[model samples]
Target: MDIDTESTATSLDENTENFCDNPTRDTIAEGLMGLIKPTVDQLDERVRATRLSQVELRQCIEGLSEELKRISEDQKHSIDLEVYLKKLINAKQRVTVLSNILQSAQERLNRVHMSIDKETVKRKVLLNNTIEDPHSVVLSKNIGSSMSLQTPLYNLNDFPDVYEPSEDTHLFIDALEKDMKYIINSKPTLACEIGCGSGVLIAALAKILKSTCCYFCTDINPKACIATTRTAKMNKVPLECTRMDLTTNLKCKFDIVLFNPPYVLTEELEIFGCGLNRAFAGGLRGRSVTDRLLNNLNDILSDNGVCYLLLLKENNIGEIGEKMGEKGFKIKLVIQRKIPGEHLFVYKFSKA
Candidate 1:
């Protein structure tokens, strides 16, 4: 009963080869799966952070508004001066809350990116080894990857620019950019964005203009300025960020001047500490900062320059335009949007 020994040897060889291939495939799949898990976990953490902060920040802003009202009424009479001071002190706590919200949001975003980097590196290793189906593996890895890894308008880390598109801020930025596209295409030169919150629109403008002779960016908040700097760097847009309030005169002359002032009106009085109040609360009708910015805008813009300004309709856009008209400025309606729960008009005005 002599078996066909050569045939038996060939069958064993084929079986061994099949066994090796199956294990190799399994190893590749396992490595890819491992790489995806951490990134997904990290992304979930970021989404949670963003949601929590959004709620917290809104609450802080509302609290600050109430405190402002109390302080305003207190200052009307001389007897309540001491009480006013105490209220001012309490407002500082609200500012702290706002800061914490921003910090949390930032930390969560960082964690997501870190996780993405680690997973990407590991996935690449697996992909390289599985050359027989590298493309499919890469596609699978990407589908399973968890991270808000979309290329932002710019790099937030390097640009330090704030690009908060949610709520009223989004309306302000989107409208301003649309109107300016015409001028940006016609005249490509130096431009400056004042109070560049998140720098979302500035980055868009930079992308449009392509070659700017000089781009100056300013924000009164140190954090915002830093963010703007990072955003500019991330987008590869050349710009300088400075801490400057619109009430003060700016040194450089720009062909284009853009600003979106905090138009929310609050009655809080703080001599030295403006806090989060300065960021958004416009006085009585939310036009305090807008008025000041408009008053000083003429000083910063070139004689032949055009300026694009953002103001909420609730903040008295019509009244603002009337005042600018009296100042010998020509106003053009750039964009008007009635967003649910928000009302604003972005105008393009030039001194005549």
Candidate 2:
């Protein structure tokens, strides 16, 4: 506290004359300052501690705010993950459903295609009946030929395991028709056919010589054997069938042999494989099955047995003739036909 000049003068006058000689005003002021100094220092220390505590509290508040923000972000991220998983599940289910629907649609389309094919065939048959003789059929011709080799959809539906007669089969029948007179002249007692699909070949022979000859056929497929028997019954011909691989187990000496082999080029493994492949899967150069038969032709034939077989252009006819010539057999091409995607020939083999 600052003292007024008048107050200091009065105080100095009231003090002892000896104190006045020592500057009493200055001494009192110094004493008062000394008494208040410790309290001032204590107040200063308290202020500093309060500021430090405030700073620490502010820092702690800031850390808590940061922690709350992190928790909020984590919550948001967890929600996002849950939504993503849900979307993935939904998409997967949709894709699976679509796949099943597409598969069903494809199956329906195939059925529609089959129905259309059958309808078309039926219409054609009706049209043919109107134009030609009503007694004649779409699958057969009786214009002086020994057999009608035309095929319709019935063969496929009736016998799925059996080969459906096509161009090769027709060509084979035409070849036999051309050589029918020669076959009759020979007057064979026993006739056998190898791999007689649909039994058309043997049935044709049986019809012409039913009384004089015994007709027999061998087929790798039981369905073909059944087809042969059925064909014989239809044409009023007597025929017997045995399930054998290219005359492998025949006990009779056949005077006439007919073969319409699988002549399409394919893998060797498919030569004897299951299904329709056995009908048309000719191995390398389309000669595996044909060659095997040719190798044993000498033993398979009788003294005057004549064998007729169908061959493809890929089967190397020159090599076949040379090989047959070596085995004392004469090979003559009876009939040839070019149809669609194939060039085919029916050859006659006779002992020289």
Q: Per-residue CA lDDT of candidate 2, range 151-203, in tens?
A: 21123347777765555666777777788788889999998989887776777
Report the error of model 2 at residue 257, Å.
Answer: 0.4
What lDDT would candidate 2 get against the real structure? 0.77
Number of clashing residue pairs in every model?
Answer: 21, 0
- The window of 10 residues in a row where model 1 has the poorest summed lDDT is 147-156
After superposing candidate 1, which stretches have Cα over 4 Å from the reference?
Answer: 1-163, 247-249, 268-274
Model 1, range 1-352, lDDT digits (tens) per residue?
2478888998999998998789778998899989998999999999999999999999999999999999999889778576677556345433533454466467557968998998899777776778766455344545535422232353445333243434444454555445544765558477888777666557766765767557777777777777777777778888877787752556667788777776544564521243444666665566766777778767877787888777766677778888889988999977776644456677887879
Per-prediction TM-score: 0.54, 0.57
